[model samples]
Target: MWVLIFWVLVINFLSAQEKFTVKKIVFIGNEKTKKEVIARELSFGVGSQIDTSDLAYSENRVYGTGLFNRVKIWAERDSGDSSIVYVWVNERWYIWPFPILGWKDRDLKKMFYGAGLIHTNFRGRNEKLIFSFALGYDPWIEAEYLNPWVLGSKNLFYSVEVFYQRVKNRSKILEEEFGSFYERHLSFALTFGKRYGLYKRFWGSIGFKEISTTGEVPYMKTLSPSGRDQMFVFGGGFRYDTRDIPIYPSRGFLVSVGYKFNRLVNCDCFFLQGGLEFQGFKKIGIGLIASRFFILNSFGREIPVYSHFYFGYNERIRGYFNDVFEGENIFGGTVEYRIPFVKQKFFKWNKAPLEEFSILRFGVDLVLFGDFGNTWFNREKVLKLRYLSGCGVGINFILPYDLILSVGFARNDTGRGQFFIDFKGGFE
Candidate 1:
């Protein structure tokens, strides 16, 4: 009996070694990009034998670049040596455009139109350029441009961006007895940073921002009030990311710290402010995010508009609008589950579709959210704890554009519910 078991194990081991072998590799459709560059992105290479177990890992490495729409790998045996490996990739276009629409209250709605263009591998050097513009119904417009490059003879990456924005507040006669004043401002920022591998991966950047806004609103001018505030921001923060993707991080912690100098354009009080953010999760697929801000100065203190203490959209909870709760010292959190389904299969070259619009996916989440922050100074005393508890379901569609359109619905404890329909990037 012992001799029979030994003989069976030996035969199985020999068969496994004979099943997989690599001789050479050929890459097609990569002109401006170096073949070696693409080869390094793969988990398997020339002279290395391949197995079915390694296929998914190789596919993920290339698709993670956000530059390819489709990738296919094939193996052909060479009667001379061993087996020749062939890798074929279909690249996506560099430029794209889209529109945006969102809702809050029935009376207060928001709409925007925007487009962006990105160029990868420009001039045969692995550099990127991005340009975008947005215009909206709330009477606002913004434009920005970004350039990122890996520094000469170094692994360091740097980027520079310029932005301009203007907004006007319009009143609804039926919604309120009095009208609301508008806000207009102009601002500019400059940023620089480098990536490092510590206990985990991290990126740090230092930047400066200058913003000036007008104080005279139609209502403020008529109602005897102080006008306008101007602020200058100079600070630096480091971000630690363990997520697989930067744009849509599934697991990681993102923390930012900054200081701002706020001076009323023509007033007596000038203040200094500090901010912090904490975001991270466990791989069992649960995530958490929290942020806070504080101000200290010779004059009256001011909380930055970008600072929200607890409640809002995309921060602690979904199915809500941005900055829904205006206040100092806000906090929010979310719990989610991520489950994946589906396996890849091979087909004839011409018969295979360029993209899989939908890959099998399953996700369910329970959320408990609340805000204990307020916008006005000394208004913290009046801050009430508003809480909402709900559950949500999502459907994912994977496509050539790498965009995902998710339709979700949630019901709150208050008996009020919300239905959300939005694009989850990389699926649309």
Candidate 2:
């Protein structure tokens, strides 16, 4: 018995120390993206000594770039203790000339429609270019261009955007007294960013905005006495993300910190804002659970109504689907348990003409969720209305282009149930 134990221990030690040199890397199904673009995300390269687990990390990094619909990686070794890494990826539909047809407040009467053209992988280097317009409840035209690797410079990135929009006022008091009114905004911005390794980055932005309203803009809504407000905006931020997938993940976390200021150069409007957000994901048996927490606060003597934080606008407490809250400071958190009903699968249509649209991946997840949030104007009001919370169950349709469509029903502290349809699958 003693002799047998010694041999077993020696075998285990030898296996634990096993390593292989990367002879080369071969990428399949990356017809458009350049080889270097894919290699930049990898943690190891040719001639590097790597263990078996490194291939999984390399695959996740490539997938997190949002460039691929599916990724599979493996290594093949020879008797010489050298191995060839094989990366298999299904590239996404990078160029889209799609029509936009959507409704607000789940009302068909309040619908918006338009068209847009975008190239998500411009020049096959992960640059993004967009041109779009919308008409109806909120009308807007926008153009944007982003290059994450500026001029091939090391880790540098930049973007420019021009936008025009007309939106209806959201103040319940103003809307009830004056009926309905509109605000117009025309703006442009230029931003620069730098990447620190694969999952961390920092950025700064400078922008200008001209804002006006129809039918005598109220003083509470405008920072300028002239009623027409022109302001300069500046912002900076840092982000660190390690999520296994950009769209959906079973593990890892994300951190973001940002600051924004208005009326920096030549305007009367004044507000400084700071925010922090963190999201984490973890596996729970056959499913996964995710959570997010965020806080946004503003400083300074004045903040325009258009800039105030709101719960029912872009973000929401699912139980209060139609209710909107306005405040100078807001904080919130959400938790969800997602169970796969139909796991992700990839398919190809050989008969299709466009290769970009021919390859497809789809899945479905049943999500159980709860959300809690509060909005307050001053320190005295903070946490005074803190009992607001909602819980719900939703079905997430995982589609191509890293998109998720969620439909759910929720109930709040008031015991009122509301139905909701949201994009982003609970996380953007």
Q: Which ranges in model 2 have alpha carbons more than 4 Å from their true place?
A: 1-21, 47-53, 79-81, 104-110, 151-153, 264-267
Encode model 2's per-residue lDDT on 132-238: one tens digit a residue.
99998788999999988865547899999999999888767667776687889999999999988878999999999888877754565677665578878899999
Name the lDDT value of residue 8 in candidate 1: 36
Estimate every model's Cα lDDT from 0 to 1.
0.44, 0.81
Global Cα lDDT for candidate 2: 0.81
Determine which window of 10 residues in candidate 2 has minimal summed lDDT. Answer: 5-14
396: Cα error in model 1, Å = 3.6
Candidate 2 pairs with clashing backbones:
none
Candidate with the greatest lDDT versus the true structure: 2
Per model, how many backbone clashes are there? 17, 0
Worst 10 residues of 1 by lDDT: 290-299
Q: Measured by TM-score, how close is model 1 to the native structure?
A: 0.60
Candidate 1 wrongly placed segments (more than 4 Å): 1-28, 34-62, 71-88, 95-109, 114-117, 124-126, 138-147, 168-178, 197-228, 247-300, 304-323, 340-387, 424-428
Over 299-396, each residue of candidate 1 has an lDDT whose tens digit, in order, gives 13543332323344323234453324434444443433333333222233444443332222223222222222223233444345454444454444
